[model samples]
Target chain A: MTTTTAPVRRPTDESQVSVGIAMVFLLLMAGYFLLPIYWLVVNATKSQRDLVTTNGFWFGEFQLGQNLADLFARDDGVFLRWALNSLLYAGLGAGIGTVLAAMAGYGIAKFDFRGRELLFGFALGGVLVPATALALPLFLMFAGVGLTNTFWSVFLPSIVSPFGVYLSRVYSATIPEEVLEAARVDGAGELRIFFTISVRILTPALVTVFLFQFVAVWNNFLLPLVMLQDSTLYPLTYGLFSWQSQVSRYPELQTLTIVGSLVSVIPLIITFLGLQRFWRAGLTAGSGK
Target chain B: MTQLWRRRTLAALAVAPLVALAACGGASTEPADGAAPGSADCAPTGGPVNLSFTSWVPGVEEAVTLWNQQNPDIQVKVNDVPAGNAGTYSNLFNQLKAGTAPDLSQVEYDSLSSFRLQNGLVDIAACEGVTDAQAKFVDWTWSQVQLGDDGVYAVPQDTGPMALYYRKDLFDAAGIAPPTTWDEYYQAAKTLAAADPAVKITHFPQQDANWFTGLLWQNQANLFDISGDQLSVTVDSPESRQVAEYWQKMIDEQLVATNLQGFSPDLYAAWNSGTVATWVSAAWGYSTIRDNAPDTSGKWAVAPMPQWTAGAKNAGNWGGSTTAVFAGTEHPAEAAKFALWLNTDPASLEILNKEGGLYPASSDAQSLPALSTGVEYYGGEQIFDVFKAASGEVDTDFTWGPTMTDTYRFLSDGFTAALNGQGTLTDALTAAQTQSVDSLKAQGITVGG
Candidate 1:
């Protein structure tokens, strides 16, 4: 956490009691957040019987290697297929979503368009409606065009994140008017200027948008649940849900669900670790000179 | 039926009930060909056929894979949907509305009438060998697929005839024998409770309205009687009251665990810890006990359900499902063939049973070599023998209505209230009866009040 950069002890400025309380509060919050994942990782490595009988926070008889092997080998590696589907949906959706967001956000912030506020207001309205509330209506809309079970049904909806646009518009204020006018006068076309000069200045903030969109699509359940009927097209979340539901008939899937969940989150972790510097920079950019 | 275990929640989605009505009035009856076999045309679409089948059964794809190998031209793709009454029904409804539903889908027997009402399933009885295959399935299951010789909408896949699953170690330790009648069962409950404060004879889970429906079935409490469009709804009646009052006595005496929910981790742990003794469940429940409480292997055994009258044999049923070929499929004949083989073929049946714990509804499969053998978990007891006997005693005339999802939800709500001390179990039945009749009427099905 970024808390590590902050000194807990400030002998001249703060008392030890406040420092102690702050440290304890931060530790408790971390433990609360990490405990469920820790339980999943620990249980995923255990046999089915051990899952219920043994301590949830500790290891059991090591089935970690076996569990991973069985998970991948299941249904001729269908879990891997789901993983690849998730990657495609999230990675490409986030890439395209970020570019679109940057253009819209920069246009709204920098240009004096007639309906700029009205367009931004619509985006705010989109943010107010939960994705779950939209899934059914979205499903009906897609079904109208014979696109319900297709990849584009999920991918198209994933690329239209209003929150991503909102974040970008707020961050576009960081780009200077002088730099853009200089590029414009130098005969760089508007599209070229937006892509080259404006987009580069908005890089860190756009990374923040990309990460948010990526995780939302990666963990999306209801959209895929409503939109897709084919298991071959399922994302990691829906695939694990289907397996978990069948645990009564096939008890082996209980552990597999646990292990699959643990495995599904690895890419999210990697993405976060790789891009957190850009994300953190975005968070602090508007705060200071 | 609780046969799917932890099934029958809330209600299904807003299904397009008029789709089937439109199909009748629409000019899409052009597929009839190659001479009418019985009721349906039994026609196959021209050219090589590829079929899609959707099911929630574990390892069903492997069975389809087996079928695909032998009939290379008539390939079946298995779509892994969740259990029926969950998202699968809604998914099927969505696909049906979109006209992109699979050639076949798995539907529970209880919900088959609803699907029939919605006209989701195709009439495939006229398909080659389908009429001849009727004699191969058990009497009740065969009836489940047909609608008064008009057509057969599906093939019988599995049955869930009710029986008793008890912990033999706990029973023997308490100096109690397995109960054979309701009176004896009550006596055993008192004995078990007195012997140890920690244990009860069994648990009567409030959420399991499907299980309760099975109990009512044993008493010959038929919920619906359809004549033309008229449906006689009697979920609350003398026979149902007899069964409810009997369980109400146990709940009053605290002989059953009302705190437990069926198919929950708490129920599994209760069985493992010997806090719960017997489970009056279906033939498929044998696997449920074995799989969940793995540490309690060899302590469990199965027997016929306790009778209502002395020396009388009667059985109720819980969960079972059918593989229905959906309408609008271009290849009905090939889909019907795949559905038939998946259920009745000995090799495919074995795969389904071993991998998914499905008790075959096929009469000949009842005597399969694998079924006749002893299972190691039950201390080498030939458990299927008990199931076979129970299967024979299950009343073939116990009919389900088209809006069972709504009826089950109302019953479950009432049952939950009754269990929590708001009403008697008998009152829950009365409420369920009124609500069920209303539900049927609302669905445009005529109901006798």
Candidate 2:
């Protein structure tokens, strides 16, 4: 037998040049992303007068604590109420959305039933429709049913996440069919098997879907803006926008708006960091399968 | 077969919550029907009635509280909405369409026509003593609240008569006087620019269409005239072009700064640093300037707006608002009484003037000691006297059209383009004229180009 040896390859000069170019591009993107965030952080610590008179990218005075105090104290602590409303909307919306998506996706992927392809095609089409386009029609329908201006108005539409359904389908394909067959043969009920075996396997994917939906519900502004009129029902995004529109008349609210923005970003950061491991595992699961 | 069974069970679980929620959704709860059109009783009922009023004006709550304490039968609850005029109007429009609008809303004079045209406002002509109430307000302001001769739409709350606020120190240093006419104004611009490269004579806020419209209003450029159902728009008329071309000439020579937007930090900084020698503002701007530029106190003075003709006394108005009752209110009588009392009552108007810093549109309230007293910020000058003269000189025939907001937006875009050197001011006016006609037509209104 002829012994054929593979040729050993070395990095070319052009490859090194490309590495340098890639590094430059990455740094430029880093600055582009971080500059606005840096500006927000720097300005959040400033007093109203300093915000107007001082340089935008540098600290003028350390008034973050005072601003936070004012933010929670203004209008009888309405900011806290808005923050809680946001949590309720995003947290519950995402939690429930993930479960529904997981069940639907698992069903469609494992089942060979009539209209299976048609159902999946319908879901794919749903994913193509922009959320904003549905907002007006949804508002009219809700108004017709006397559901507008309620917490349910914001919560109901949020739970119907088509993108989450799509992600869960891609994830459900990675689940092993033989494992489910083995569980069924062991005399376990289907619901029991799903709860015990399938759920454990899908935990990482579920977390991924939850996080995606959570961010979406938290960032949604237009739906809440159009649906809710009672300020008490407002989420942070809508509440802050209402306050910002009055900044020209009430200039003191400028500091409150900046400080409120900084405070609002904390919950999102914690959620992202806490669930980061599952995200990575979920991403690699599909590739491995 | 097992997979199909599991899939059916899963689908049932997925749809259960949505089905439950939809089942729980109750039947439509329509808004309380508004009082019959001609039968709205606007008299105060002896028993207590609750009324909700929405406004962005500061201290309105305090004034309403005073009224509440005095008259327990007519309770008015104040809600503060967003302060932007356009935003407030849109919110009101949405609420009105949804049949959940407040009993009373704060509407500016320029925006009143839009609501009236949409029939969103209730005719308050039958309100107690509303006919005789017209004589209590300034002549020009009184005319603004009236639709033709029979329909009374709102109670005038405040007026903003145009004035020229100049830096006395700057004028003294340049050895130049405040311009009395448009010709003198241009000459002063050139002289001031030649004297100091850093200082411009004034700022022409390209984003402020209201200010530009005020100038047009002063020159007798009747941009909109409605006769019966036919609407005539003349935004690019010769009179308006004359005003635009004059400013265009000053802009070309770099005699005026067109960089700053009104009520912005940059504009405040410019004023504080004395880089802008003059500000063409309304009466309300007096307090704003004083509050913003405290260090520059006693260095400023108010002058009448420079005339288009040397001896003419014609003037224009900018920002002012009125309290109006919505047609959808269930408590029309209490709402109407509250709206009229909020503006015409002495105690409320006094508090509105003293605390809210609102220049009173009521002639009776105009002579309040708070308004006539010399302001220490203006070098102890009676600044309201200048505004008082300007207010009287405002043309009584001036009126706003139904699409004032859209028209202002078009003008702002055109002005911004011109200021950026993409076109001349005359070209911008022409563009605005064409766009305004087209937009008005699209709104299903009859328009004569």
Candidate 3:
């Protein structure tokens, strides 16, 4: 490999200017993305009076510790309950969703079945439909069954991510049929072969599907808004939105909403950062082949 | 092939619910005649019964807790439903249609007609002492809870009689007294703007249609008139045009700020920094100002809203909500009693005033020691007395239209465009008038111009 390697060329002077401009553009984009989060952090550390009076980007009296204390202590620590509800909804919802999508995708890709294309087409249609359009109808059905305003109402809809199945199908098709045939030749059962061989090959793709569904479930607001009435079952997004609408009457909720927003972002950040390696590995998996 | 067919069938089974559910839309289980499944007796039974109430008022839980402790037999479970008027109404409407509504809901005076027309509220006229307690509340407020002379749908919990709150320091610096008439208000705006370039006499928030409606009401502009079932829309009448034209002139001259949305962060900042001199607000605004602009304490004072004609004492309401019993409640009697108790009982009303910061709609409750005392936040001023006097002057004949939500949305869009200098305020009012007529017609209601 070393003997046949090609030499890389250095950037020309004109290209260097273009590269510099591109770097500047990227830095500006990064600042655009981060300014709101920066504002949130700076404002969350302020007293209720200071929040309105001070500049949004600058530090106030450094009340982050106190704000955090108040956030957890308000309404008998309801924020903590909302956070836990969010984790339960997104965490379990994404986990089960990924497994179901992977199995359905693998079955559709490998099996020579009747109506396979039709089923895939149906799921693709689901991918195109916006979730909000389905919320009201779903709410009515669940209400009919007396299942609404419960945890299952939010979780069940969250687990049915059609886009995840579509992504899994595209990725699973890249696995070679020869590998499965070889496993069959070795007398391994189809289930055993899938568990030991296909699952390993599909790990990177599955991780990508998991992250997408996780974020979608984490940020879902309208479904929970329409479905759940009990505040105890509220996910973070709906809970914060509920608080925000009442700011006109309960002005003190302004600080709580700001601080709660700042706190809600941390778990998502950790989730993305921790799984970033898998995201990259998944993107680059088929490049070598 | 058989296995393949089985797999295909399983996949089809998964999608069946989506189609079926969409087709089976929700329907109201109760009859339109208000014959719900509950005993009509208004007396509260001495048994443990849990009642649910939905409201956005903060610290309402404290009032509920007080009631819960006193009457353990009839416990009220407070649901902190946190959307303001429109959102709460829509949510309650949905639940009512589904036959799963809470026992009681908070309905604003402006939106009460919509709820009553939809049959979302029960006739509480026969509830214990409801008709007799009508004499306890302000006449206009009591009238709002009734449909003509026979239908009583809600209990008046609070009133939002409009008032003028001004920064005394800014007024003194500009050497102008609080204007008691519309002409004086216009002159004071000019004087205040000339004294300080950064200061405006007040802000007319285009996004707040309720506040604009109050101004129109004070001018005696009957935008909507209901005679029997025939609704007439005259939103662009001469009286309304007069009020709109005067505001347009002020906005064109830049004597008042029209860009700030009410209850927005910018408005809060403006109040805190003393850039805006006066706030034309309702009685409920006292708590809003005190909580948001704490440092501005002792610099503010309350007075009656200025009049259209010199020395006229006409006033109008901006925002206030009532506790209405749902028709589908399982415990109608208990729910009715709780609604009455929450609004009229002196002890419960005291908790609402001191903790929840609500201005009382009941005349007797207005004299509660908590409200009668001078407030330190308003510079030792008996602010409630000013609001009390203003409340007494509101036009009892003035009524809210049944399609207020849609009408307000159209008006807000028009006014917001006008405020941004895209068009004149009169033109916006005309557009809003046409839109309101069309929307009401679309609802199959008779409309006349």
Candidate 4:
């Protein structure tokens, strides 16, 4: 491969025009996705009255503090509880789902046990089933044991991500078998070798799995909706929807819905950005020669 | 003849068989077939009684806090529930299925029969202060809890007596006095439309089956007659068609706006912009307009609904709810006690009205600070006086069927079709009548062929 860059060229008019056109298209694509977030942030700063009267895309007043106070303080601080519940479900759910997926994927990749391929096929099949389809069955199963409306009802079902396992197994191929052999020869136990050597090799895959599972759990609507009868037990999605559905009866909820939606989104954005380095790293994980 | 049958059945039926046929509906009139609705004795347990209540009313916690403060031993926990249609009823049904139902739940008047048919409600009549407090509520409200059986299944929480909420300024500017009869209302509607087509005298609420039912209720046009095990569906009667045709004429003549459904954003926008001139709504709907159209405050006034005949004293009702002790509750006595105080106590009634925007079922609410005052939102009109009168005028004979939810859907679809220029309102009622009877029979309710 040539180390020298292609002879440095000044920007010709034609090349500049092409780059400019692509830049415009890229900027437009970014704006398309970010417009709602921008609208949400702008509207979150407005009072309930300003929400209807003012321009939706522009700022109305500096009332984010008051809005938060109102949103959190309304319904006896249930919104804050819902936010915390979202974080708990997503954080713990993703952490556990990723670890389980990593172990199962690593086992299937490194070992030749019977039913290993069958189990891999099952995990791949699990990825095909939408979460909505399982919500009702999960609800009935949870209800059978007097577990519905409990934290475990929503949490128990969320911690099994077959896609995460599939990704982990696929990524596990990147870890050389010689690395595991050397670790075994050095007197490291299987668990220790997987925890230290294999986990390091699977970091990118683990992070991908965690991000996918975290977002899924955080934005999950159907499971919590069916399992939870209590509003206090609701995640952010369900909680916001409850407020939204009542907007006709209580118009002030319109503001809270917007503000609550904005607040709920902050954690997701932070989660994605905080782990974007690893997420990006996973995108190029097996592409290396 | 049907009333005679009901009187006899209430006294003769056994409680055990009723529980077996609960989903087919009898409003389980005694302790259920389980540990729930506990013992029959109305005596309070000497031990600490913890009861859970679920309600859709806003600011319910304030009343619960007061109840908790006064009786620390009988602590009542308030569960936040959305409005009935929003999921409260579904949650209650889920709880009933799981055998984990809350001690008390908010059941709407129209839905009471449906719940009763499912055997979801417990007979609280035997509970202390239940029967004695019957006289405190309006007569119609008292009958709602009874469900044609001798048992008081619930305490009536709120009543939504119908009244005319009109734009006082617009009426005055147009020299149109509030109509006192349906004929006069028709004239006034024409006058408003002729003067300005943009400003309608009222919007026909096509999606609001409850409101239309209220109009029927005022004319003594009840859609159901439950006699023993036999149900008579009367939704397509002369009384219903008379009311339907009058509204149909309004639609054909373009005297009123159409397509504004129940509590939609478009309806609120119309109210705020003064495009809608009058809303024939219930007493509890005061906040709906006040909160949604804050800018249009002090421009409204309340009046009694236009009569069917001149000098007649008939009024409709729209929405009301009861606090029912669930069939699965372990503390029926405690639940009944809380229900009584929540609905009958003056302070609790006042708080419920002021904070939750509820119109109390108790006659004592007529004297509450919330009702007695001249509301600033309605140009200092003693608006509730109209409702208080309307409440008294509601026909005690009017009854809800066991399949009101399905009936509502059928009628709403019909009304939507009628409004869209497909058929007349009378046609809608006739179609709804057949469908309602079919649904009743499908639910194991015996309907007259």
Candidate 5:
């Protein structure tokens, strides 16, 4: 390929026009993605009165602090409690579950063993089943074992991430088996090799798995709604729903629900922004290979 | 990536403290105080009972709290589920299949036939506080909770008698009096629209099956004729189509504003602001209007629902629920007793009404001076009298076929489709009826031949 034959266009009128169009399109995409979050933030700052009176997307009086204070005070700061429960469920479930999925995926991808394809296929099939369909069976199984309403009832189910396993396997497959065999030749055990070698190479995939699991568990409602009867154990989604259901009766909750919705979204935004690099990297790695 | 990992770790570390905080806010609601004498000792000998009572309203909290206080030995827990009539009841049936059935739960009077057919509930007619209390309720209301074989599976909650709530100021602004007939109501709405396009005379979500349900009930159209275990929807009937077409006309003429269903928060605000002129709602909606639309106080007043004909029944029930004991409860006696007291006891009703703003279901309790007292919110309009008179005429005998939820949802969707001119009224009705019958049969609900 000669440099002279290559089409070179820099700062031409057509190029500039295309760039302008691209900028506008990108801005629109960004707006589309951010609109709901923006509305939530702006809406959170308004009192119930302002929420109804003013345009939805624009800022009203800056009552965010008051709304948060009221939100925390509602039914004795139950919203905070729900947030805590969600964090516990999603955090531990995602953190440990991601590491396990990484190890399992690496084993399936790098190791040549009987039933490896079967195991991967099984995990893929598991992902195909809707979470709601499993809720009842999960409840009955937990009820039989006296695990219903306990934290473990939700945590145990969240720990098994089939999608996480699939991604990890695909990720670890790129880390050539030669690297692992070399580590083994150096007297590193399988567990040690998996931890100190494969995991570092698969960090991008691991982070993606963790974030997916974290969001899945955090947003999960039906499972926890069916499994946990004790209000204290409810995650943020279920807790918010409980508060929302009563809003028809108690209009005071309208502001609190909005505020609660806003606060719940903040952690997710931080998580996404922080971990988005890993997600983007994982996608690049997959497509690049 | 490291930041994401740090966030996850931080979120994980924060979980314990957050859960502890949520645990602090637990309402730990138990039954209300005081049970009828000897009702406590009626427990059947068994292992420590773990029965459940499911209800749709916070009103049942008073009863459950009372039971927990008075009868701790039996130990009945309550699940105040957060869904509407169809959603919650359907969940109950699904829970039964899942073998996680509550000991007691609420069932709609119209939906009672389906519940009865399933035989999933216990016969509480034989329980204490129920057999003798039947006569005290309005006979029609009592018959609603009664299943076949004389089994009373549910305790009656508040009745949903319909009435017209209009902003008097808005009406005066439009230079029209309160409407007494359907034609006059449309005329008033048209005049109100001309006076100010923003001031909608009535705001009903044409897409919501609730409008259809209320209209059909008001016109006394039996949705289905139930024979033995069979069910059939009468949507092809003149009255059913009449209600559908009336709503279609209202939409086409732009007299009624289109909003999403189930207590539209925006329209509620509009109503308070005097932008929405009139709303046809049940007795319970009064509480919502009074609470949410505080600024519209003396500006709002109750009137009879506009009639289709001069002598036709002028009201229809919109939303009402009942409390039933699930058969899985270990404290059946205590649960049933509590359910009864909550539904029937005047003191409990008084507390619920005062605190929760629930209209009383008990016949005697409705006569309390407080029930008739003028509300300062409505400019001292004594609406209790209006609600009380209308409650008597609200049809109490609409068939809640097994496909009740599906029918309502399909009809609601079809109504929207028709109103949007996507389909004709006949096409919409036929489609809705077909979908409803299919859904009912799928649920194993035998449609009447």
Candidate 6:
């Protein structure tokens, strides 16, 4: 038998050098992505005086506790009220939206019902619509029903995530139909089949839908900006934006806004870190391996 | 086949009503507070007149409260719209359009014409307490609230008479005296540059439309010539060209820093650090500077703005607001009464000035003993008196056209483009004029020749 020459490893060669370069590039990109977040964290520790004087990226005297205290104390704990509104809007809205999207997506992907394609097409069309253009029409509609300034105005719109449904549909399609058939053969009802068999297998996709809906509802501005006129009803984004607009005349708010931005992202980070495994699982499963 | 088709038709009919009902149910939910009390409630013996006054600042309510203490029958409730220029204006506009506009509204002088165009303003000329007090206000400001044949649509609440606030120590270091004319101002800037390249009279960012409008006003240029609804565009006038050229020269010489757009948090820090040598500010600018740059106390002095022509007046109002009654107000009389108390009452002015940085409209309010007291932050200078001395000279000839706000923005952008060498002064102004005229026409507003 002819012996194939053993390939030599190129530890110092051009190809190896290129790989090293790529690793450095990726590290730099990672740093670039994380820098704003790092700066936000450092900023939260600063006093209003230090905020203007200190380096934007460096930590000054630790005033995170003090800033939180002041933030809650200012205007008689309006920040707490805004935070509660955001949590309700984001947390509960995302939870409900995720389940609805999952069920809709699973139904579209797994069912052989009539007009399924038309229903899928409708869901797809929702993804193409911009949220801003919908705001006024939504406002008009909501105003007619007398819900324009209430929490329902914000929550109801957030709950309908067409993009989330589409993602869930695509993800759910990969589950082997044989498994669902086997569950059905075992005498499980359709709802029980979905809840027990399909849902357990679709954990990764559900997390993705939840995360997306969470962030979408959290960072939403225009809807809340138009929907809520009362200062007492403002979300963190709208409340901070109101303060931001006045920063030119009242510069003290500049620090408050920066600090507010820092504190605002904490829950998002915690959610991501806590649920990172599911995100990874979704990505891996999405590759169809 | 007949049975299946009939079932499908029945299903369609069943769903149609549900969809219509859902659509109907989704829209009826805007929260609207009750409108102000009607004329019936304005009777002296009527229970009370509850009025809603929409404002974006905090201290003005103190003034309202102060007024209410003396006049218990007329009750004013204050709501702070989100601060910042756009939020304040747009929020008010939205409310007005929704027929939920407050009984009294605070309208910026520059935006007064636009507000008047919507036919949403109440004429206060016939209102009690405003007849003799008209002469007390600065002439230019008095005209801002009056439009289209001098229909007095509002009461002047404050004025922003421009003055040069400079770092005395910085000027001393450069061994140059403060400027009194535009030529001397340019020369002084050059002199300062020769001493230290970093120093400038102030930072002028291109994004601020108000600052440029103030300059154009100082140059005696009107954005529009409003005569009988026919508008004549004058943004390409000699005075505008001159202002543009001066700004370009300052930019080429690198005398003015472009960092301060009046929005930067670092702007106050720069002032404290002495990087910015001077700022052309109105009376309202004092509180911002004093509060932010407390470290530079006593080292700063106020002077008249450098005149555009030799021996010409050296002042332009920065920004001022007025109290106006919306046209939809159910209780025009009560609204007018509340606005009058807010604007012209001496006690109200005292309370407002104490709580907020508002310069009172009433002449008697300006003459208050408290205003004459020296400011510790300004090194014992009776700053209000300095502002008062210059407020009267503010030119009343300037007019706010329907497209004045749009034209002002175009001028700011054009000036920036010119300063950055993207185009010549003449070309920039011409383009700005064309763009503004085009925009006005697009909006169905008439422009004069």
Name the weakest run of 10 consecutive residues (lDDT summed) in model 1 chain B. B2-11
- Chain A alone, TM-score for each of the models? 0.92, 0.91, 0.94, 0.93, 0.91, 0.90
lDDT string, candidate 3, A43-128, tens digits: 99999878877888899889888888988987788899999999999999999999898888888888889999999999899999
Best by TM-score: 1
Q: Highest DockQ: which candidate?
A: 1
Report the C-alpha lDDT of model 5 over B299-327, residue by residue, as the tens digit. Answer: 88888888999656568777666777654
Put down candidate 1 lDDT per residue, A1-289, tens digits, no spaces: 4344335444444455566667999899999999999888888899888775565679989899999999999988999999999999999999999899888888899899798999999998999998866776677678889898889999999998899889889988878889989988899998999898888778888998899999999989878877877888999999999998877666778889999999999999999998998767756764665
Which should have the higher lDDT, number 5 or number 6? 6
* DockQ (Cα-based) for each candidate: 0.45, 0.13, 0.31, 0.25, 0.15, 0.19
Model 4 / residue B83 / CA error / Å? 1.9
- Where is model 2 more than 4 Å wrong at Cα? A1-21, A112-117, A187-192, A284-289, B1-36, B39-50, B58-79, B84-88, B286-298, B346-357, B364-385
TM-score of chain A of 3: 0.94
Error of 6 at A62 (Å): 4.6
Shift in Å, residue B180, candidate 2: 3.1
Residue B223 miss distance in model 1 (angstroms): 2.2
State interface RMSD in Å for all models: 3.3, 7.6, 5.8, 6.3, 7.0, 7.6
Better of 2 and 6 by lDDT: 2
TM-score of every candidate: 0.91, 0.85, 0.91, 0.88, 0.84, 0.84
For model 4 chain B, the run of ten residues with the poorest summed lDDT:
B11-20
lDDT score for residue A150 of model 4: 87
Model 1 lDDT, residue B7, Cα: 17
Give me the runs in candidate 1 sitting further than 4 Å from their true place. Answer: A1-14, B1-38, B147-150
- Per-residue C-alpha lDDT of model 6 across residues A120-202, encoded as one tens digit per residue: 89999999987865665576567667787678989999899898889878978988999888988999999999898888778
Give the per-residue lDDT digits (tens) of candidate 2, residues B63-97: 99998998888888776555535245654654554
Ordered by TM-score, highest first, the candidates read 1, 3, 4, 2, 5, 6
